[model samples]
Target: MTLALYSGNLLAQSHEWTNLHDEELRRRAVKAAGEKDLPALVSLTTAFLTVQGKSGVLTSPRTVEAYELGVRHFVEFATAQAVNILRPGRHDAQNYINTMLAAGRKPAGVHLKVAAASALYRALRWAGATEADPFREARVPKDPTPGIIKRPPYTEDELADVLDRADTHAKFLLFLTAHAGLRISEALNLHWDDIDEAAKRIHVRSGKGRKDRIVAMSTSLARAARHYRGLYAPGGPDHTDGKRTTPPENVFRYAEMTTARYHLSKAFKLAGVDFRGFHPGRKYAGTRLLRQIKDFGRVAAHLGHESVDTTRKGYASLAADDLKDDLAGW
Candidate 1:
């Protein structure tokens, strides 16, 4: 009777003493945080992000968001094999790293996943749920050189087909990405005042890495922008609540990236072309400009790259075989 009472007391007390049955590392991760499940984990993540922001360790919401994304991605990868979140060893870390590497993702992309995995480890430790740091022995993967065969840029014809079929707002947004080589965020964040139709240049304020640049517009892009601007003049979709509004402040202000993705996909379906995600639009632009300009330095300047090497390595860099045709001419 005394032994039974003791056992009951142990069961009722802190769960850490008991060998808990965790399903696929999910329970272990939550329980390690002294949490019940995913909700608790999310709550812990939010709390951690808030603390990080307040402490100035990570002041930007965008940075915190990136961390959160990394956390979720890591959790998905690590929990696949179901390790003890509280007692995860080096093997678990290696598994995640290996799995990510094996997936053939670009090194830059894999680096984000690895950093995110590390962030989750930090969160767990900071939450006082577990002192375990599974990623302690984690190693970063190696980045590979860029080649033409790698991540084949979408063709101009594909872009044209999709552009012709897109809705009014989508056309302007996609035009910037496809022709101007603006990132999706850059295109969306554009203001009407930033457009210089006479100059034929689109000012990309705060592009990737917070760098700003101007992208010259194509004839088609200029025409599309003029058409969209014409709509902005009267009671158009951009100016629905027209109450003394001079012009729409942000060009694609009402357009959401998610909605744009949907529209792009729909347009591709209608055009009978395969649709990759929007970044391919940037790739298409870069490759086209590189070929037309035939100079990596010039292409880099046009694309607003901080370095010519980046332009050469990413957009204009051709594989050894791809340069064979030019070699014959040489």
Candidate 2:
């Protein structure tokens, strides 16, 4: 396999290469790939991968592996259509979509693969490889369309029981995610510098779009954060600071997503909570915060959402009490 590296535009540096219009660029990119220009192929693949990473879609290494699988499928389709991977035409893309649907791939799965392929073509075009976007004309299947999957939230009683049963770290993370409405990635990437103990705020420097925002911390979350801080303090026994005198940059080291999920799941199980995963912790958190604060704008800001509409879409489930109150009026 030819190793792909990301270096903006590779063909620009080649003396034998000539910059062409979109039409000719598409033809040349396909011709060069047919001739097996390893560097060109690598550059094209790397460019798309880089875009995926930047789009906040590829959050973990596992997701990247899945993207690679999608890439492989696209390459195979392009080869079968006798087209270059970078400039497969609309007909080729449409045919590939049909083939995938016929192969019994789930609509959601097919959509993801198609989106990845489309992104790849866009990147190739951006890099001056293609003229037209093949995906623009590709006919994606309409039925069984993919949509966002939202997990159910834990009940208030169940949430309390889980917190009551959780260990210090698990409890802390739970409160941070549940009450504070921090995404797992945002919470994991948090450092000591991001926290303001006196002010009871956490600064999110790099979030979904690399946007920075400050979120208010709950009292319980503040206390737990301080406790976590003590664990990393110099001379606090777990510290690696020389003479235990200096602080580390990060509060948690090598915080794997799997481990965090396992611990939270175990805690929920022990507490007899019905939740099967950690995302519900966030869902419940957002819902509870909205109810307690009764301010959509505040909840959106706390959750780092761009707008209140997004918060409502994700967490606006009516409670039994709400239904009961409405029925009373009838």
Candidate 3:
């Protein structure tokens, strides 16, 4: 007979987790147990499940799997260093960094691993497991991975050419993402309820770090959305019976990342634009908005950045031309 340990009431005192049903509890347990013998894994997993669940992102299976994998990697590193299962230290973190280097992990991959481990340490600390955060002392190598290089902004003529070549729905999605500075995930996850035609704004309920903000929609974007809506709406003889009415809660699911890549690759080759994908479009939008818009705060709000500094860092390159023009005038 196998004895099953009941891990109940761990969250009984916490109002946030107390109301969680059976399915949520089981999911949390499974995620926590993914790692081998990180003594506080169970508690850390519970914390993640609670926090992310409240943030409305815990429903994404992919996100949960990524968390589990990250936890597993940390556990493996901790075990190799003979770190105390419940009380890891700075030396353990150092050893893990050396081991990762020895295994030929790239700087970015190592950074992610270290960051993930740090998150786990923080989680464990939150759960009353230990006082030390070994990751605080875990030094990332001197040569940190370079940030992603911003691609050149698309010229107005090039943009027109790409739009003309793209399919109708693809064009609209591309325009929204590139012109509006929406992330691919945010743009793809948009629903009809989020759009306010009269207000000329779209509420981005989900953003990076689970923050919410509203972005003003361009007239072109609003028009395209209305057109897309009409295309998806049921009408004519097809809806005579009235039973096949389109659902009010519909969202456009065109051009997923992989599909977008395939189609955009073909479009790029045909247009000879040397552009790759939608991310460049976002960069273009950000750069253009920063350069053309007089107010940094408004630009930051439109792009849903926490601060103007983030906007500056992302869009500073766009100012080079303005600087050149000023020098010429001087």
Candidate 4:
């Protein structure tokens, strides 16, 4: 136990992820928060992300992604209201929130943004920010819309057609996500060295929730990787004679998110399939896995969701017909 504790302390020191006591954390947050300029706010926002990441407070990249979006929204509203969010009052917060509700967006989604903003406030305060939480007195009206939100996954045939039409890189990305349910960031961060062809598994580093886990890759995915590596090698189509022109560490060379979106949109168009956005692939994987096992927990485990309810909320919106066989069994 002593040795293990020592090792744990060493690891924490190496990564600096140890959470400071409330007082010290607040001091650092306040130091980062005092600057109200755009650049300072941006830096503070980034600092919040870093502190959360190091402290294991952030679980998923999506959480970070959502926080970044919320911070941007907060900053814009602060600028418009002539208030610094770090030093905001109830009035400024209400005004900013009013715009969100006025836009006719659903309340649940808006609440997420508000929640993120509140989290930033707490994070800053812990770091020593002296400002009052503007959201303390604010209210986000409840959304009356039915809690269920569902989208149909792409059919196997439609997905195959998309793959057939996709460029090599896009094909790999789309196919992997469809079969393995890898989030786009996970897919993009995939490194060749992480793939275990023999075990048919890939280690997803710091996936959603900042947790590392392994997911099985299909045989076809391995084959596709090998084929792409060959083509993109020194003599392959993507590279020239330059040594520095070696294949990138990432399996897929595509980096721009917009470009991937455009490719998916175009592929769906050419394939004559209904486009339900890139998320359908993940939904398809989760739904199919749930169907086969009839176990929500198992399916959620594969998808890296800590709670089965979250998996159900996000991916359980299936059609009545998909359950015909199971219903018959009953």
Candidate 5:
């Protein structure tokens, strides 16, 4: 059947397209795109992405939000230029790119927006929305500086000071990332069952890129784990109070990443240290391990990195003392 016939039937069945769930919207979008029904295609795709966010297709909520913003920006630009959003020519796409660069948007930010637009086109094409992908060959400048130069890792002493100022819960959170090399999300989602204290190993399930790895915990991390478990774990010796409180499954009780970050930031404030972010703690772990073992491969494994080059490029940086020692020997 023609897309027009399908869209008419779809509209007749549902007065408000926005009310449909992601799956329903997805089906409608495919049909609308196939039929080349401009109004229905625009409405269904917008509703599918902005509201419910192409759930299974997109990896995270952050990506969904970024893509939605990117698409909105592109639509606005197209409208202002009297260009069709779904069928913009190369000239129009180039103009948008030039406009963004002229406005002094950072290279990374521009890349993200362009990538988001590219993703939107991909989805559309998959659903038979359009044959052209303007973003496919668009150029985006690269950020020349290395990540380590931008955000250096926290020193051992600095992390220690933050730990000293932190509460028990906050301390455990820091230990997971700084000492055990867990990502902030991994630490926040960690369950008691994932840890093998005696073995000194942590099984990280579904880390970045949907991959899992075994992370070795440091002595300090193990100590912190035991202490946290005693007071806060589901069935620990000191966990019970007078009333019956249903114990939480995850180790850290904070339900939101922002809340966890707030506590960590407060500790940094009390310790009189700058808050560079949680990833630096993970970097600290990687650098410290590399220093001890003199092996990039092991450090990469510990950091759950699929490539050793990533660990070397981003995590491994020479300590000031190490650099000085090499010069002193000369």
Candidate 6:
């Protein structure tokens, strides 16, 4: 076993990853991965997954969490089989996939777990930890069912009710997505200077796809913004600090997406509405706006989508009730 070679390197650098800061872990991990530093790669991968450092990274928390969960299952399987997890054979990977499927895990879920296991082996190979990638050709069952149905956007009446029940900060967050079509991340990242009350427009900085866009606010959204600003940005968009007057760096009182999501769900419960998630509000904005304007490209731009096709596919599906009036003539 090449474990003999790794044992010597581990003696010197086994504790190195523990001493490094979370921010420094990723840079060192990349270097370790590239230079085939197996001991460093092992420690760094474990450490990086544990803290995940900070926000605004290329990968999202959701993806990281999913991968973590998947890897845990593989670790458990490896332990029971007495297999060298880092040097698993192709049959070991196949059995793991089969076990997950046999246990009634969804096909998609099994696939994701298999993919996570495959990713670990790829890292190991890159770090010269092992040449074996059992998961490389492992067969994962295809999902028999179509993708999960997404929750539909809220109706205008339902959104209005939610707004009425929400307080200051929640109202602004909801309005940003429900009316202005800002993504939850974009909304949370907003600053007072990004809003233009006079022009009824918002400057979304570094939205999805790392693109900046200008979005027009609906009349109702503008009203909500004014009310929110009156309470939160009471400094009138300019605070005199020493000699300079600067807008607040962030518009919302809450900095984290989880905080914003919690408040939105609370408001939904209070309003007696089913709590679906933030995207519904954005879908409402795009779908309603497209209904009024009947223009795909215009609505896509308003939603900060780079392609009109995305806007059309996501927001253009119409229910039978929506077409009742138009079809009545036939």
Which candidate achieves the best lDDT against the true structure? 5
* Tens digits of lDDT, candidate 6, 30-144: 5654444544444444334333433313444345545555555666677677766655565888888888888888776788888666655654453444577787677876654
Q: Which has the higher lDDT value, candidate number 5 or candidate number 6?
A: 5
Against the true structure, candidate 4 reaches a TM-score of: 0.72
Q: Between prediction 1 and prediction 4, which has the larger TM-score?
A: 4
Candidate 5 at residue 162, lDDT? 90
Q: lDDT of all predictions, in order shown?
A: 0.65, 0.66, 0.61, 0.66, 0.71, 0.68
Better of 1 and 2 by lDDT: 2
Model 1 agreement with the true structure over 1-330: per-residue lDDT tens digits: 011111222223323322334342344454744322443454445445445534332233345456556666665554666766666766888787777778877767777877766666665666455777776777766667564446667786877787778887678877887788777767767888888887899888857656778889999889988998877634565566543322357776454467667767888888888887776777777778876666777777667778887767665544346567678967
Residue 246 of model 1, lDDT score = 28
Clashes of each: 0, 1, 0, 16, 0, 1
Assess the local accuracy of residue 161 in candidate 1 as a C-alpha lDDT between 0 and 100: 83
RMSD of each: 10.6, 6.3, 7.3, 7.9, 7.7, 8.7
Model 3 worst lDDT run, 10 consecutive residues = 1-10
Clashing pairs in 6: 90-134
Model 5 residue runs over 4 Å out of place are: 1-83, 91-105, 236-247, 319-330
For model 4, give the RMSD to the true fold: 7.9
TM-score for predicted model 2 compared with the true structure: 0.68
Question: How well is each residue in 104-212 modelled by candidate 3, as lDDT tens digits?
Answer: 8766567877766766665554444456677786776754322224345566677778777876557777777777777766776677788776787888876766678
**In lDDT terms, how accurate is model 1?**
0.65
Looking at model 1, which ten-residue stretch has the lowest summed lDDT?
Answer: 1-10
| Cα misplacement distance, residue 127 of candidate 4 (Å) | 5.9
Which is the better candidate, 2 or 3, if ranked by TM-score? 2
Which residue runs does candidate 4 get wrong by more than 4 Å?
Answer: 1-36, 52-66, 82-91, 123-129, 141-148, 233-247, 272-276, 317-330
List TM-scores for all candidates, in order. Answer: 0.72, 0.68, 0.65, 0.72, 0.74, 0.67
Regions more than 4 Å wrong, model 6: 1-84, 89-118, 132-149, 234-248, 306-316, 320-330
How far in Å is the alpha carbon of 12 misplaced in model 3?
12
